[model samples]
Target: MVSLICTLQDHRDDVNWCAFSPTLLATCSADKTVRIYNTQDFSEVPYSPLSGHGYGVHCCCFSACGQYLASCSTDGSTVVWSTDTGEIEAVLEHPGRNPVRVCAFSPDSSHLVSGASDGTLGLWDFRTKTLHRTGAVNDTTMVACSFTPCGQMFVTGSTYGDLRLWDLDMNQLHAEKNTHDLGVTCCCFGPKILSGSGTVQFRLASCGQDSTLKIWTVSRSNTGSCKMQLLHTLTGQSAPVLSCAFSADGQLLVSGSVDKTVTVYDASQGTLLYTLNQHERYVTACAFSPSTPLFATGSMDKTVNIWRVEDGHSGHVETATFSCEGRKLLCHSRLLVSDWSEEDVGAWLCEEGLQALVENFKANNIDGAELISLTKETLASELNIESVGLRSKVLRKVEELKAGCVCTGVPDEYLCPITRELMKDPVIAADGYSYEREAIESWIATKNRSSPMTNLPLQTTLLTPNRTLKMAIGRWRTSQ
Candidate 1:
């Protein structure tokens, strides 16, 4: 059931978007600035709002790692912010009158993808801070874009009521279909809702000017490949369904509408659960906490309401205030949102690289393409990804991308302090930092008994391989 936690006047103008990070909540507005609030330390008011765009900011997003914040504007530029210091790291601008509608970081925090009113999409490299790809493949003004949990598949909706799915790795269109009868305003991939046997079953929930919320059944094969099919079409909102989000466990779906209402549904059975009517104006956006039962909604009335999403049986428990208990809150753009599938690996690719590897490894499996099916961990550990040194192989590609480039220094996060080279085997050391396994091992054996980067006494000589970093390194290497 739905229960109000608290309401905050998050913006001076219509709050276009609001997302939670582990420690903060960031909101964007037509006022042309972004404000961030501390989740745990509410004693201090928010610092000065961030502003640099020529026009009102339309959307904002905090990278998965929570190290950076990105905001897009009607002026056609996106600014990346260093969250800790509230400093701008990069200002990304594209030529044309196409106002950016939304922006989001790939789950791995390796790429930033943005959609525009001109039906254009741009993919920017976060590590190198460069715009590497742009496309005008859609003819209608695009309304929203979402990357599936793996980042291999991308979904986009347009004003003309159509949806297009693309294979990011192949850089090829996967499917195009009409689900909404009018402008497709927003869409999000459902969380992994599983069956009794522990099998994954997910759905795509979309909202539109048509006043209908469409639920789609996403079917997949043994190989991590999948397809979407119409499952259930929910119609009850008195006006346009402005935005929607799935609970982290995929047990619930929450939607906001121009009717000034919020609806909750049993995601598995597609049954109405609860309806919240606390807003004075149109509800424009909604989001759920990454690992809690908390739900939040943003509206044109200039307030953000946080709610507790309980099971249908609980009815509603009134909550006058909300507490983080150390839970990081996150919110995002018009449609760009949290990862749809698996948990975010601290070091990772986007699904684009996962897609490429799946397709390439299909022939080698005894189970054929089905064996390449993507599971929760992405690829199962049983697969022979290590047969040929995966670390060294991908690291070499990274150096190749730097050949004759004009960027300044290499992104420090991706380099190994010991060797000052792109890391092939990244591992976490005792000091809660990452380093190239070989390089750090050598440091401990021959160099001083201190952390090379911080010069602190070594806590331990042990190093654990970081699988996430391996995948991310692979993606950047291949994309370049």
Candidate 2:
């Protein structure tokens, strides 16, 4: 049943954010509009459109309880709306001409953190309906910000290829890990699983331009400092990851890549479990529902795709066409939304979207260690040559072996008796038995099984299944 359910189309421009209201759904689009629609009907009733930002809308998210909606704009304005009346409850404005990239509500729904092109963090208090404080950093622009599930703290990533962890309670900075060589695009939190144990706890997953997905274990000490250690690195796709999400059970991870593929991986082993290729262009966003096996994705191909993650329950519907331009796609249960694709080339960005899909256990410093070691071993096995070096050495050895450079001094036990031809596709018998083509060849070459055997070269023939290869071999042996 891998199919996508069709919903209503309300946004005229690229829809950036979609959130579930208690009974309805709200979508924000670059058309400088936010519209609320009934979940049951795709038809649009009378809806309020908040208009103030001079530029396109970037993103929108609902508060924990879905009472308030937060929207960020390319003009660097952040607005909070009352869901009941669609009135502007709070406005967050920045002086810089930079665009607002992301805004997220804390678990308590009291504070909202926003990242913008100005390289600053805006913290707003809902009670005051005003900006609480703006925190500035020396880094490049910030792209994505996320609060831990516990809401004790938050983290932000930037185009400078760095991630900053912060503690909200103490306002003290925690450990920072810099791994990607490029900007981060998106980030998601996942659960930490104990090795070899079925039960799982909580952890964080991040994606970025590095074309990698990383998992980190979040740690907090008694001093109120947070530390995130690398857990695993998942890499296979060649393009930057744009989005990622964890399944409802927290046991599966799905990632969308600019390579135009959505890959499902074993979250624990970082194994490439499945690849679903339906989008013709980059897959911008993906989300899993509260129900197991159900998921949805948005893509640049102008579609909202919904499918079941379970092995044969694919909903049968492959893709959902939106009939509009899409950039960032997200799904909450069955609700789906998409955002505009960014055009600015050099702004601070979210964590690279690829790293959020896998677990990256190595420290930033130890990265590339495995690749270096592998290269070193490959070089060491070759003979030393002044000019041609490894290439000449490898060619010379290949020629020698091809010319039957059998070693006479070596002990028979230390040698591999199977010839190259036999080892090419060797197989063991079901009866706990093994045979080598070389041994059989030697017996046939020597005309060994009978007295009528001659040294003449045996005729080789190809026959159909009615005269199987096994029968041919039997016939040859009998002729000897």
Candidate 3:
């Protein structure tokens, strides 16, 4: 369900990090630069090529409000810049060649927290433009940092297999069990959940050098101590998992790995859905666009790959095998008119006309969203379909699909066994099961002489109308 959108090649060196605002994207690179690009155009901002960092920028993050951008680098400093003007507003200098490994903006955009390799941690206030606190997380190298949605607390992780939370200047251990056996590389907060009784819970996802991703459910206790419970541990990457990003809705998660692949999973079930392997080198970062079904991945290959997630309920059929190469189409879609007879097409478009309409829009290079917002007349006109009869049939089919169904409360036994939908024209098949005429015909065409539900051998291919079932269905329809 992943389709390539476009490829961005602007960084002269390895792109180490990427972040997304509501409508813009900012990337940091080993080229000693940070560039912000409009999501609309995917072009660098006019004043971008921001090159204040004396060394490679290792990480970049956007404030919750999308008004500011923050970056950390091996130059031993962190800079906060205005996203609109591309101006550096604050500079906090440290004392090392070691990269400031991790940084994140507070939920309120009022503060930024950063950590350096040697356990050096600092919290800076945006208003004062000064480092308000400097400390260390024990004696371990901090690799990951994130703030909760409410901005009341922030979390930090170490290369030493530990996770800690900061609350009003007090650091508290949130997980009794270590997240991974090795160093934690990245951690991001998942979507928030509010229970029926008003209890709040947040999901935290982390990946590490152990080559595993772990999800932890966390909550605040009455005494204000964060309580943690292990939810699930996902393991598939052959190499260390480098980064993970959660969709804004918290239903999906994408993790990058040193195995040179990006794995997408259902966040709630930990079910692996897709594995993207376009990057030649290790995938360094992953970011989900907040306002669209889009995500961008950056790697050591220095190219940013954009992808779109498809949301159709995929049928167990090979739809198409065409790529954007040589303008060739070798498709096998069941719904295409070229592949199906006119009667079959009519039958299919009758039951599932909405989906077929979308498929037509796709094939005709029409905007599918227009089908939703445009009136039937306007849509039909916009399609500019060559065959007037075909256009009328399609538009009439759409109206029938949209018109409210009058029939309801039909007996399940009178329904089509093959389609699981209420029968329009019931028929008796050789297998002796009642089904919609079109449904059983389709089943026989696809499955030969076998029963759809039982797979039993069929004695004949002929079908007869079920007069009894038809009468009952007719009465039900009339009553409704």
Candidate 4:
């Protein structure tokens, strides 16, 4: 289920684009400003209403590390700002001094690309703040740009209704003509790289004035040849689709349309999931949070609406008593086994259909911590269990608990500063702190250049995997 969470009405003009970092949301508008908000409470940041652009801002995006924000404008410049302080870091003028329509940062945050009204594209080296190259298509406005997960290539959509793929060297790799009957409005590459049988594949979603959203599979074979194939054409929204984005996991797709509606789909299956009708005017922009089950949509009415996707089990009708009880026990399974009390252990055994063992567990005063450590020897000797098969079943259930439990007592140090979630793939950042690899990478790509904990400038954007911490977390999980 999806429900509206909040509506932000701070923008004074048409909202042009919306973007999200791990912990923040950014929206640009025709009022010539960019606003930043804390995702935790949906509160505006202290230095928000960023006014660097001389003309209406057209697009905005965060650097991978969440250190910087980039916004383009009709002023013919793409400005990069320090997300920490909301100060302009650099101003990159487009080659032809044309109105900049869209800007995106590469996955590694090493490059920033800005597309212009005259079809000119500027590729900038983010670290050195220099223009690395320039390329363009003829006679059409460049409106959309997105880099592939591998960072070796990117896709661009233009007013001419064409989608073109280009390598980092500014060479055109492939082009699909008439992708949208009228004009292509936006395009985004999924966050994952799928590889099998000597071919690397990517998913791309593009929406257009044709009033449809198209999913395409772009693949590169071992021989270096590339191909693009249409996978699905979504028609949930009746009016022209203006913007589209993929969830961080690439499992869901969302689009905003001129019909004053927002549509979300199961991207993998090409099935409509929900249609939202909250905006009073044309919906122009939409974005999904990289680390949470939340999405934001912006409209020409100058409002931004935040919506949340709830777990499927929520709000479902219980068909049977056993099913309701099973659902309740499943919720409890999220608690760390180490923190479970004796009663919790007893309840767990009942839920596991080992009701005969409940009294045995309670008689010996076994709790969650002890339950996780149980083995065949303990079941036979300490718990006084006689049946070998029963003991093995109990041990197997305990093992499953250790592997699946997502408990609340995770050590603070083991949580990513950006997402505030327990780190699965921990990595040490240049800030000398550990974070989930994907979280920090998303932070670096889209937020400020400072340490999330220290509020001090980060010296570099490099991150090193914390394998030791990863192993420690694994051990802790097993112990729980």
Candidate 5:
């Protein structure tokens, strides 16, 4: 595994907020400049220097769709920038004291929220470019506020060590929890909305200067009473947590801390998975990709370090499939997506489907050169799992195609079953390698063992589901 660290060309002065985009990343610093860098080459890109704020930029974030960026400044002003043109589209000023430290956009891109040192929270409508509401927050200087993915609710935290959840509809406090000992620097919501498992509408996580991280299970009872329950507290670290981000699936959490370390933990179990001690100074911000199983951490060390997780592969074998399906299922089960685009999505899924075919061929014990010849002619053919059947001769052809290739897919194990989208850290596997919907089809084709199964005229029915399942079928067995 190769790890790359990114640093600015000129050292930034008092950089406060940094956000990642699909193709580029933006950073706001005290030097009165916002620098945008290409994610691929780490090269600095030309971005118009925004200078309306009198003092400095404090916090910034990219919209969920990556179309707009919102930033707050010490001058109690907020501006929305067009990601394509690097032009300021809207400038909003809050008549508050001191600086506006943090701002976030709702998931729908309709509302923007800013928290200030003046202990006030300001809300604005991005569509109308008008202030919608302003309210006095708790004594804690409201530093960070984020809307839940649903956009119906938002949570705000402050230096006074208070966390408050609000309902935008009723314009009332849904719940309030004062559990931190210091300034609450960062917070994130869990990916999965709790439904049938219990009343959990969402999971909230926050970190503060108290050197403690807490997780809360927030639920709305049928009677309309919102309850915030303390779920777990992580307290092994001695440093104040600066920023926290949940993995794509909320299965894992990553925290950047003043202790110069980035810690990874199982969000559900609160188990420390790994600690990256490579940064030289305090870690400022951490983010995980929704498309790929990779994490990015920005630090006072003035660098963004990228790290990847490893998944184990069994072995390669060859098999023959005499039967032929009309079309193929292009499964990109193993390809990793750091930032996905339309073209990337199509290419990844196609590659993964072919990879599944290749693995099946090898497991059936097929030859290499023959597989290469098959891929050269058939890879571009559109194939869906519903149309494919597991006949022995067909499986052999799949082996032939994959042996001619390297890197069948991404290394992450918890991938989407259909689209083969790489699950983020804390990813939960609802089904097979792809999304849940596609996983069922994969299972039917690869499994469904009861009577004798047929690849060609040959009948092999003794194989149980466990034996034929992708998780178990291996070409090389040590015990054997």
Candidate 6:
């Protein structure tokens, strides 16, 4: 089930756009400020309420590494802020000084593109903070932009109802005119790339004033030619779809609409999954977290709602649940890693492409439990494997096996009492119980000092970092 976890009401004006990094969420508004929040607990970051924009900010996006955030505004510039300290790193003035409507970072964060109200686009070299090239379309405001996964090309949508593809040099590769009856509002490229023979294919989603969301397949052949074909036209929302985003895994798609609703879809099949009606005003922006089963939607109601995808509802799978050939390997049909016999260990070694060490592992009688306990020292002293590279490879594969076991079994103690999720940063509260740091902090802030487990008042609000528990959880995670 999908549920709203929290509603952020920090913005005093309409929230124009929202973006998520690995650990932070940024929301821009017509209030002329950008706010940053900790994704862990939805608390405002200490350095939030970024006021670098001179005018109302229209859009914001995070760099690939989450190190920087770029925001564009009616000030006719895109300003880059350091995510670490919320300081302005650079200010890129859009060519022709037109109001910048949207901005995006390339897959590698090497380039930044800002679309303007005057139909002009500024391609900036992120490292140098300089304009690399400028391009424009006649009589149309450039409002939407997204970079393909390959980083070699990007797609732009305009008020003219056209979706145009361009290379890094600002040359138009293909233009799908009249993509929407009225105009395109937003567009995004899926994270995954499909390749076969001499062609590489990408999935692109565009929403427009026509009240429809369209999915298209963009293909680039070995001969360097590009083509775009419409794949699906989704009409899940009753009004104009203003924004759309693809999940990190590209398995799900979400869109915000003028009908004051948010729609989620099974992206691969273009089938509607859920229609959420929690916002009282037009939903203007939506984004998915890069590292979690969470998404955020911003609305003209001056709020941003955070939603979580429940465990089974999320279309995520453990990498270990599949064989090398991409066939499903049922965990119930095989022995757990901790219970595997010596023969099982040997077979696993072979399957991992360590056939040369199968005999060595068998000779050592390294059962599953023992395999989990193996260290570099054990490999060198006990197994007498002296090749450093091979030892490293084996250890890496073993770590992968451990990580694969996380979904099957995670220690209850390693989970936070409030969230019941594995604690990445465990801390001890005044109640003398360990919990996830952010989870407990948020709890104390909202529940008025009550201990989550004991149901009694906490004497103090102080929290101490539980280093030992954190290390233990880390090791367990590596072993899982």
**TM-scores for all predictions:** 0.62, 0.58, 0.64, 0.66, 0.61, 0.66
Candidate 4: residue 169 lDDT (0-100): 88
Question: Model 1, 183: alpha-carbon shift in Å?
Answer: 1.3
* TM-score between candidate 1 and the true structure: 0.62
lDDT of 2 by residue, 158-219 (tens): 77667677665426466465656687767666633332233223466777888887777766
Kindly indicate the candidate among 1 and 5 with the higher lDDT.
Answer: 1
Q: Write the per-residue lDDT of candidate 5 for residues 65-125, one digit (tens) a residue.
A: 8888888875558878887878889888775444577888887888888887667777787
Q: What would the TM-score be for candidate 5 when compared with the true structure?
A: 0.61
Q: Better model by lDDT, 2 or 6? A: 6
| Best of the candidates, lDDT | 6
lDDT by residue for model 6 over 14-79, one digit each (tens)? 799999999999999876789898888676676777988755799999999999999998667899
Relative to the unseen true structure, what is the C-alpha lDDT of residue 134 in candidate 1, on a scale of 0 to 100? 76
- RMSD (Cα, Å) for all candidates, in order, is 23.7, 28.6, 23.9, 19.0, 23.9, 17.6
Candidate 2: 10-residue stretch with minimal lDDT: 343-352
Flag the better candidate by lDDT, 1 or 4.
4
Candidate closer to the true structure by TM-score (higher is better), 1 or 5: 1
Cα lDDT of candidate 5 equals 0.59
Give the Cα lDDT of each candidate: 0.66, 0.54, 0.71, 0.84, 0.59, 0.85
Report the lDDT tens digits of candidate 3 across residue range 194-268. Answer: 443334578889999999988888787655656777788888688999889899899889999999998888889
Cα misplacement distance, residue 244 of candidate 6 (Å): 0.1
